[model samples]
Target: MTDRLTIRRPDDWHLHLRDGEMLKAVLPETTRHFARAIIMPNLVPPVVTAADAADYRDRIMWAKPKNSDFKPLMTLYLTEDTEVRDVRAAAEIGLIHALKLYPAGATTNSQSGVRDFKKVTRVLETMAQIGLPLCVHGEVTNPEVDIFDREAAFIERVLDPIRREIPELRVVMEHITTKDGVDYVAGGGDTIAGTITVHHLVINRNHILAGGIRPHYYCLPVAKREEHRIALRAAATSGDPTFFLGTDSAPHTDAAKLQPCGCAGCFTAPNGLSILAQVFEEDGALDRLEGFVSEYGPRFYRLPLNDGTVTLEKGPPVEYPAQIETGDGPVTVFDPGMPLYWRVVD
Candidate 1:
């Protein structure tokens, strides 16, 4: 058996490092294993402009651990009011990596997301022209669409039409959670790719709704059926360049999670790499883990791979904290529900 492995330091194609106290607490969990991440912009007010992205990036840098060379690839929250020139400038100077699209009311802090896609056509055209990829939270917010079916509905009702209209606009379908999602991205050709979260690969809806509602397993673009989870695992472990890792490791305090109407997110950053190693090892795809977590993301983003490496050694079960304390409150970590034998030793 391959008990030890080393690869290029990974990059999270999608990550959420909330501001202030939350940012300080979670930044290290990722930087310790990942060299860079495409930081989410779903803050309260949202990072909507080049200036907003710059300021947010600065705060992240300040909060990172000393001597950590973790880079935050910033993104702007796309709204009807987003300016084309600002996006162009951000892309030109390499200040922002992509612009995120959150259908209004799709998830937490998405109140400012786009309500009308028409309003952003000019911006989309500009992005396609400049080769700036759009990272999408691929779910529809319509009240009538069943939560479980939102992702597939999105591809037909929203994503497909948009792609057809602007075939040159590169897109990353973030946190894709269904077989439909896997099939779509696999065949979507060069301009499209998908990101699969570690949590989704391990859990299905039963992990949350079964056994009396495990709130911690709850997350937006909520986990689908076991069949879908199987599909996600296959796509992620298939070594296909069309799929890569995006933890979507959103952290919310335990207090917030235990409420009657709790927030949707799994704080997986703390043990994401460990869980991924375990998952890949089980599937007999240990050889492909590096490309999924480290290489494909950078290639899709048109960025250089990291010079450093992280080593994971497989031995006894690795214990990780169940919750991480922050200035705000204690945030529960995602439990893969299986003992992980591989731990990053370097």
Candidate 2:
């Protein structure tokens, strides 16, 4: 058994709450545990414009479980033609907490993403001027590039250039997967930060292929080798503000996931914190868990930390439900399927 401890209420630095009924269903789990979440903008049509972002924010607020203060910090989806004006106005209105950069064809609805990073140079300049952070998908999509190599290649080809051009930009390299990514974010000056997912910290590519195709474990910026997973663990628990938590807890229906060619995502919001605490405990970094989960992201984003605290006790393992019923079909939330030692206490 493990001892109990209290930590500042953690914020989920990355999350995807799909729209409408799906949104209403999974949102409560996230709000119950996290104080705030940086909401992803990769909806079907995407939330590229400020109007779209504002409209979506209203929906999230409306869908939120009654009396819950789970603040959904919105992000603008970047497109090739995303205007500098929209970027500034969104941030200025306090509608967009950050701007998301998804290279076209990189992930799910990211087909509407930006085709050329350089083309958005003007918009980036304005973002630098306004102090809005750029949260990136961080993967390249050239057909010839190996799926495993996309993220590393992107760091060299796209991200480095953006870093040079927008020197003042506060960027979060979303869902980092490899040693190179860990090195870049950890080594870069204070302005560079990255969100590491629970899957990345706990499992690797082999774990996905471990018995058979484990579609639920799959996600874009796909898991890397065991070595990278180790590097990710080091980065996550290193007690660095540049390294923090972002579950990237994206969900897809079970039928969609179990099909011949399943969708990319993991519905982890429900068990995200318990799994995180388990990872930190395994790394013998429970003392450092509080910083990664609760402190660093807010400090880097310049937001005030929540005054509330949550206590997760070392008790009986949690049994996460294997599937959830959705409007179209059942959806599978990512379940590591073990005795989860750390569970949230009421």
Best by lDDT: 1
All models: lDDT? 0.95, 0.88
TM-score of 1: 0.99
Q: Given candidate 2, what's the lDDT at residue 50?
A: 92
lDDT of 1 at 159: 97
Error of 1 at 307 (Å): 1.1
On TM-score, the candidate that comes out on top is 1
Q: In candidate 1, how many clashes are counted? A: 0
Show how many residue pairs clash in every candidate, following the order shown: 0, 0
User: Residue 235 lDDT in model 1?
Assistant: 99
Model 1 weakest lDDT span, ten residues long: 301-310
In order of appearance, the predictions have TM-scores of: 0.99, 0.97
Model 1 segments more than 4 A misplaced:
none
